[model samples]
Target: MRVNKLTIAALAVVAGLSLTACQNDDTAGTGRSDSSSSSKGSHSGGSAQDTAKDSAGNDSGEGQDTAAGTGSAKNGATGKCRTDELEVTAQDGTIGGDEDNTVAVTFTNGGGRDCSIAGFAGVDLKTNAGTVSAERSGEPAPATVLKDGESVSFSVSYPANDTGGSGVRVTGLVVTPPNETKSVTLDWPGAASLPVTDGSGTPVRVGPIGSAGQGS
Candidate 1:
């Protein structure tokens, strides 16, 4: 069969249209795509175009945050920090002169989003006997927004066994992130086993959760 010049021109136009469609699919991420954009034929057809658009949205910053598996709450979307995405730890205890010591509860963001957390983190001191939930300071605090790898901390001050008498051996600690149901567990960081007036109760004072670089 002999091909005419007109037929060649038509095929070239079709090829150009296909390439342009693919590019549009690849670039449409967030904020709603323009209705004016056009797409007719893709090299891999409609399936390819759909996949490209989906990927573009998923790869965007806000998209990654909303879809992140770490349960992180995105800033504008949820405004609550996910518990599972935080790495919680307790630093060594520093004893204040008044028979009380401060333990630092550090929270690091290990996810992809900027999240906000506030108030007193649920703290519990655990022993073989039972669990003692922490009391809130009842003071309001500004929500701390954290980016990836950013951290926030709070202080828990408890009475030290100054009398050096028989004291209960502290075994475990439980920490809950703000507005999250999940909690983080850590080992007791007491200079020695904490002493209590009685094994049944321990008076623990906790500070409000604050942003990184702020004194807890």
Candidate 2:
């Protein structure tokens, strides 16, 4: 009877040890599965972050390109009118009365781009006596922008002597556009004789540049 009891106790102890070994194996397997899942999650998060960074980088690059394009456009804007790019002409007309003779000087933009002009042109009548520079009128001079093939005009005015023999004989005109140092020479559009003064004895006056047909 004593031997049987001892045998029973030994069997119970062996069973308990086997059960503990099985529990340990299950815990280890669960820990390995949790570690693998965590590693995969970390890899997925890293990939997402990388993708977001790349998208942000692309957006930043595009913004810089747009700004560069705007700067380039500003650098390539239209400039001021040049004397060599204009075609100038003169025509004869009368104001107030037939005795008040006027010369309309027209400037046409012959360039390929738009340009600006303002104020009075420097006008000097080439006379047999010498060069007579014109006086500016009190009219308001505004800035004028001229596109390709567009034209602007100003006026040079003097009274007709009609007395037949007491005036300057103007043979030509030397015209310089506003703010320009160069000049162009054109033939006088009126009779060779021009009175240096008006009825009030005002010297020859020049009007401000204006749109076509606005001269005088």
Candidate 3:
């Protein structure tokens, strides 16, 4: 009986040793797997951060481009200047014969910078047929100044005269600023006949005008 008991005890010791070995192998394998998973997670986080930084850079670049484009339109008609902001318009019922054709020449400074109206002059009247040429017969309008984004105008008068028998009246308008000269023709299809006949039996006033829309 004692010998049998000893053999059974040895067999139980061997079984316990085998179980310990298996447990140690399982723990080592689990540790290796955990370490690999941690490394992969670290690499993924670094890649995400890099992507975020790249996206932010692209956005900043786009913003800069947009601002540059807007600035250009404000200075040049296409990208930087407000070229169309300045213009001229004539008043209604302001044109007639014998009476001062009260006209207004308007100027607008579309540039970001301010500008001034130095002075203005009226050009002589010319005919399409080239038969007649009128002299600077009347007084010119006075000098005027303008501010940035601001506008102003003055009045002009035309006398009543027979437009050289051709019956066509054409007048030239010229406005001279410190930096530029603007000209435009004021066309009257037919010169209004003067109420009184002149000494030469020709109509006294009325003619076509050429425009000098030249500006600096």
Candidate number achieving the greatest TM-score relative to the actual structure:
2
Could you give the candidate ranking by lDDT, starting with the highest? Answer: 2, 1, 3
Candidate 2 Cα errors over 4 Å, as ranges: 1-77, 95-99, 196-202, 211-216
Pitting candidate 2 against candidate 3, the one with the higher lDDT is 2
Steric overlap count per candidate: 0, 0, 32
Ranking by TM-score: 2, 1, 3
Evaluated against the true structure, the overall lDDT of model 3 is 0.48
Tens digits of per-residue lDDT for model 2, 83-183: 99999999986656453578889999998878989999998888877777888877899988999999988888876767667688988988999999999
Q: Looking at model 1, which ten-residue stretch has the lowest summed lDDT? A: 30-39
Q: TM-score of predicted model 1? A: 0.59
- Candidate 3 lands at a TM-score of 0.40
TM-score for each of the candidates: 0.59, 0.59, 0.40
Error of 2 at 110 (Å): 0.7
